[model samples]
Target: MRVALWLAAEVGEGGRFVKQQLREAMPGVEQIDRRMRDLRPAGWAIMTYRDRAGLAPGELLLEKIGLPVWEKEHRSAGLRVITASTRRKVFERDGNRCIRCGILAGEIYPDETEVSARLTVGHVEAHKYGAPSGEENLVTECSRCNETAKHLAAPRFDERQVWDEITELPRKDKQAVLAWMAAGKREPSRVERVMSHVWQLPGVQREEIFRKLGRSLS
Candidate 1:
C-alpha cells in the first residue's frame, strides 16, 4: 500500500512521473513496479509512452486514480484469485479463442499488424459487484480485448454510423445481427464450429486431414 499511498499523495491525477522516481521512493521493496500495475484493474490509469504521444520512454502519465486501494476496506477491490483449474476449464470451453472477438492465440488482428493476439481469461461482467471467479463467469479473451473490456479505451462509432451499415445489410443478415445482439453472443455456424476444431490440429495431422478432404471433394 506504500506505493499506492505515494501515488495518491505525491502523483495526483494528470500528473507525470518516471519509473526511477517510484524506485527511489520505495527503496528495497521488491516488485514495487508490479504493485503500480495491480492498481489498474481497480481503475488506475497509468499510461506509458506507447499509450500517449509526447512522452519520453520510461515515463508514465497518471491519467486517473481509481479505487483508493490504500484504504483498508478497498484493499481487495478488483482482485480475483482465480484457480488454475478454473482457468484451464474456461480456455478449453472457449476453444482457446477469444470469446469476445474470436481471435486465436498468436493471430494477427485484421487491422492491427503490429502485434499478435495473446490469450487470457477475462471476466464476462467486468467490475461487477460480488462477481464470482467461476468458469461460468469467465471467458477466453485476447489481451487486447481484455484491456478494452476493462476500460473501453478504444474509439467508439456513433449509433447512426453503425445503424447505417446495419440498414444496408440484407433482411436475413440484419435479423441474424439482431439475434446476436439480443443473445449477447454470436453462435458459430456448423462450418465455423468445425473450422475452430480443425485450427487446433497439429501441423502433420492438419495436412493429412486437408489431403483427405480434398480427395473426398474430387
Candidate 2:
C-alpha cells in the first residue's frame, strides 16, 4: 500500500517532478507505470492535474500513510491531472496558493505534524468535461480546502450565485472557468464539457443517474 500510494501520487500525475518521484520509488519507468495501474483496485484514479479530481480514494489511503510526524500533512484526496505539466505549471502559476481561499502553500504545507495542511491542486472543471489539459488551467490548494471546493463545484453551481461559495470549489475549477472566459467561450459544456451540465443538476438528481451503481450495495 505504501509503495502504491507514493507511486500513484507521483506517477499518476504524469509530470517531470512526479515522474522523477515515481522513478525514485521504482527504478524502472515500466515498473512505475505498472505500479500506478495497481492503485486502481485500492480506489486510486489517475486524475488530471488541472482540477480537484486527483485525490483518488486509493491515493487518499496512501496520503494518510505518507504523513511526516513532524510536518503538516495533505492528501491529494480528490482531483484530476489533465497533464503532468498542468500540475507543475499550476503550482508555478499561483505560487502554490491554497485553492479554496488563496492561502499560501507554505502555510498549509508547513513542517508541523500537529498542524494539518490541506494542500492539493484543483481543476477548474472535472476531466469529464474534457477541459484543456494546459498550464493556463491549474491551481494549488490545501486538502480540506480542495475537498470543500470539489463539493461546492457540484450541482447548479454558479459563481455569481455565491461569491463566498466559489472559494469552496477547487482552484483548478476557477482556473478552468477563467480560461473559458478569456477565450470568449460561453458554452458551459466547452468550459467543462458535460460536467457543467451535471453541475446544473441537483446532487440528488445527478447521483440518481448512477442508479446502476446501486447494484453494488445490494
Candidate topping TM-score: 1
Which 10 residues in a row give candidate 2 its minimum summed lDDT?
A: 63-72
lDDT score at residue 113, model 1, on the 0-100 scale:
51
lDDT, residue 200, model 2: 73
- Candidate 1 per-residue lDDT over residues 60-167, each given as its tens digit: 988778888777777876354565687789888887788777777788777675457777777777756347767888888876777677764675567899899999
Regions of candidate 1 where Cα sits further than 4 Å from its true position: 16-21, 31-37, 47-61, 83-89, 105-122, 141-155
Q: Once model 1 is optimally superposed onto the true structure by TM-score, how far is the C-alpha of residue 171 displaced, in angstroms?
A: 2.9
Candidate 2, lDDT over the whole model: 0.47
lDDT of each: 0.76, 0.47
- For model 2, residues 1-218, the per-residue Cα lDDT tens digits are 34555544553334323445556665644655545434322234443332234443323222222222122222232122344565667765654556445455546333334334545555566422234545655556665555454453344446676776656779998887677557533323344546546667899998985575576677
Residue pairs that clash (backbone atoms under 3 angstroms), model 1: none
Which whole-number lDDT from 0 to 100 does residue 192 have in model 1?
Answer: 81
TM-score of every model? Answer: 0.72, 0.33
